[model samples]
Target: MSINVFLFSKSFAQQHTFEVKNGSFVYDGKPIQIHSGEMHYSRVPHEYWRQRLKMIKAMGMNTVTTYVFWNFQETAPGVWNFSGDRDIAKFIKTAQDVGLFVILRPGPYVCAEWEFGGYPWWLQKVPGMHVRTLNQPFLDSCKTYIQHLAAQIKNLQITHGGPIIMVQAENEFGSYVAQRKDIPLEQHKKYALAIKNELVHNGFDVPFFTADATYLFKGGSVEGALPCGNGEDNVDTLKKRVNEFHNGEGPYMVSEFYPGWLDHWGEKFVKVGAKGVVNQTEKYLKNGVSFSYYMIFGGTNFGFTSGANDGDSPIQPDLTSYDYDAPISEAGWATPKFDSLRSLMKKYVTYQIPDVPDAVLVIAINEIKLNKTVDLFNGIVKNIQPVVSDTPKTFEDLNQGFGYVLYRKKFDNAINGTLDLKGLRDYALVYVNGKKVGELNRQVKKFTINIDIPANATLDILVENMGRINYGPNIEKNLKGIISPVMINGKIITGNWNMYKLPFDQVPDLSKQKSSYVAGNPVIYQGAFKLKKVGDTFLDMSNWGKGIVFINGHNLGRYWKVGPQQTLYLPGCWLKKGKNTIQIFEQQNDVKNETISSVTKPVLDKLNLPKE
Candidate 1:
């Protein structure tokens, strides 16, 4: 590899020629560093794209990097959505308009603490399917997705007079674990190379690279491509790791330098503080290295699309707010971290940054009265149709995803003993004859729950998918809603079971219902609030138990009493000016006379992190 390391002179004609040579990025025969920040367009509302970009630029970033969530784009099999938050082209162009370049990481598998590791839930429908390796089904799906995605962004490349200067072939491929134990690491390499081919075949002539943490470069790095590391170390450290593993003769890059870590439901909100972030920022910028801050602006996960983390322990669901404790808050407001970083970056990088934009609008809503309620059983729609099976099946077997499945059976004789759910996927709300009994939670790694079944009584188990394992070897086991049958007293209860698929896209009309039946059972609470002026807010879940919040038919996200996140962010963009409806489906808790409220501040219940 040859290098042309020349200093970029502003007085001279601004050369836009970008290439990798001699361990440095050369622009118009001059060395250039990419001070980039990662922020997903899918997470933020389309209305705030430009404002966030401006915020990123004012923080001394020269470029914006983002992951294209395949699941969010291709919601259903064969059906694609590129409009709204899933619109990638508009986002890239908006970044460009804000005077920043773009780095696109269009992963068929992006393990950014996202649901199903970015794989569409529909992939679970394919029989004998495998993922994240050289599997035919996954490869075919990836190819079709890439082809469709490339068509939308091919002309938008910087080479084609667009803002996207770099492209990542596959995200963290070297860190991949095969779907099957029999598969070899070499198969992973073939899978990555195939994706590289797909990218180049679709006319992406820009520099293509792969990103991995701690310099794991085996399956990810390919011939003629760059290997990048993701961490908080200085320039020399990131460069040394990538160079020793791949090539010392190429430009060094930190693809995902972490400023803050992701949070699980029961874990404390992850924060790196302003001092820690500024200390690292000063070192990397002054040392002539390129880096991208992972999630400089973490947005809301919104809906059941939020995933869980089961890396090597008990299952932990991710909170609704992707706030990340980043410099830019989830509400798009700047924190002290923003102030410190901006002051530090101006001290080093010799570039002009514009003034910081004003913070987003926020408002406090009045306490909402949940006047009406509908029992979950009363609200069951046509899709909850029952399927009688001798042996219980998983959600995929029933062609369902992202919801709860009810399994119930009736016994003639009285049995008083503990019930063993051999293969309960995650969490199951237990009920006896429509009465709440107990719960079996897989988060604590508990599979069995104590129960006393009476004579001629019905036993029902409602299993929910608390997001799919977003990272680690457990990903292949991402089946939800009871993958195996339940056993009690060492006997397989051989009886017909009714399965209700609760894929509640939207809440049904509460007025159509007679009245609230039971409290402990799953119920939907309905309320209305009149907004004189729309503004950002957080729907407080402190008053209720575990459930999701839907405002004006839009699924904001989930919340639980055992939460570090007790509120769901209600972005002003999602709110209308008039009366707005708020609905919540509490799985186990009863909300009778209690009412929910909306606050301006988010409650990252730090006190509850270590407990339940």
Candidate 2:
């Protein structure tokens, strides 16, 4: 790094004021240009934050923007966490130490493709709770949360001699819901205004901003804060929208300039090529537009927290790897895009950008073998005390946020016809009398299947909460299990039932099972391998089916045979120098032998998009 960058530091005592004036941000009475990158604090490991921040600086990015995930912070209502990877305060300080300014988006609803749009799962339980709206119950809760969250980093603002210069209201309010005659879009503008007021009233005194796509600025931006656009290619068009929305007090910027798009499970991963992205960056730079790359370094989803996309299209569940085919890979390795863009940035940036750091090393190891198995049929020992109900309850109704829930019932009479799960939250497997009959998935709109109910046969529907919609309407209405009672032959059955919640919070005890298992039943594969040295690796998922993997008890996230994302990133921080345990729970599998191996690279660019 250049000595000039540090010359401005060494002093956090004297506070300075920052303002948005005449199409630009001015600091200390001088026009300060911001070339920022979006990096989520919750997504990356706390230990590697400095490395990623340093990389952002090396890429010639002058600022770093991040969203504070309400869901991640308040895991349950009123219960809070800000330590370790959830520490946004520490993330900001690290950015300042690395000479990068900060733009904080503390969204009560951040549509970052995060689960429930960053809302806590408990919100679904609130009666008459309408999220991202004007409902008093929701807003009152948001207000309290705002006050609490602001108290943590209010002093980090530029006025307090810290790097934070901007904060955002509810994200992308304009494109949040498609226009409907039944529901007015003006309601969103009102909601945006409410969000701005909430931030200001709760001590977020920094300049607040709202971001959306180019044409949606009017509905997204409130009168008090600056309005920013998302896409590239048309600066003049965006400037016009800002002029029309913010009373010509233009401090034009692109808050979410998408260098790459997010990926959903089963679909081919998306990647914006190096040559074009560099060109696009140059266009914005030449026009003197301040912008932040939407996802500069996309990481992992970690647990069963990957959100879904639901609206016009069929449901799209996000894959475990949050590696959005960005400049930095999921494993923190700089890609060709990083190199090319850094080279182009050198020609425009006034400050000396540091040289690109060496790519993080990845160590691949041989396949580890497992001889013992635990089937899910017997894994029922870990399930919660079964709830009996005439009507099946949702995951939230059962006081659960994630994982699978099973509904079992037996019919008194034999029937052969279509079995309808009026509202299946996501994926489910149908079983009758200990035999797999069929399957249904919300992703494909498959909710009914032809089946036979032998006399008094027990019917079981094991449903997985794929993930809640994080970017659109109907977010609150996505109940995990069956929303209503099973309908056979157009009649709702009122019968005795068992509802078992499988949170997968703890691994099921495998030693007590004394019965034989079905060939395609859920298999818990356990293996152990000695590690000579700890480093990063991508566990090959080609040999396995859909399910989650845990190394040393750390949930690495989900994986499927679906192309584009072929490996699960295994961070070395979770590894040890000696014997390490590998545990995997396959939902349904054919692999007789349980084995695993690691690779040095990620499968980010493969296009396996299905044909229409």
Worst 10 residues of 1 by lDDT: 1-10
For model 1, how does the per-residue alpha-carbon lDDT over 1-612 read when each residue is reduced to its tens digit? 112112122232343667777678866577888888899998888999999988998888888899989888887888999998888889987886777878999887898889988998878777777887787888888888988899889887767667788889888876663334466767777778888888899888899888876546755676667888877385666767677765555577778888887988876676787787787776776677688999899888988878888754568788888988888888888789888888887776667877999877899887888887777765653325688888777888887777778887888987767788858878888988888888888887778877889899988898888899888777788888776658787777877887877776666566756556586878877888788899888877776777777888888888877778888898898898888898877887665645777898998755353244
State the C-alpha lDDT per candidate. Answer: 0.79, 0.79
> Which ranges in model 1 have alpha carbons more than 4 Å from their true place?
1-15, 177-182, 232-234, 378-383, 591-593, 609-612
lDDT, candidate 1, at 420: 87
TM-score attained by model 2: 0.94
Error of 2 at 46 (Å): 0.9
| TM-score, prediction 1 | 0.94
Name every residue pair that clashes in candidate 1: 23-249, 23-250, 23-251, 24-251
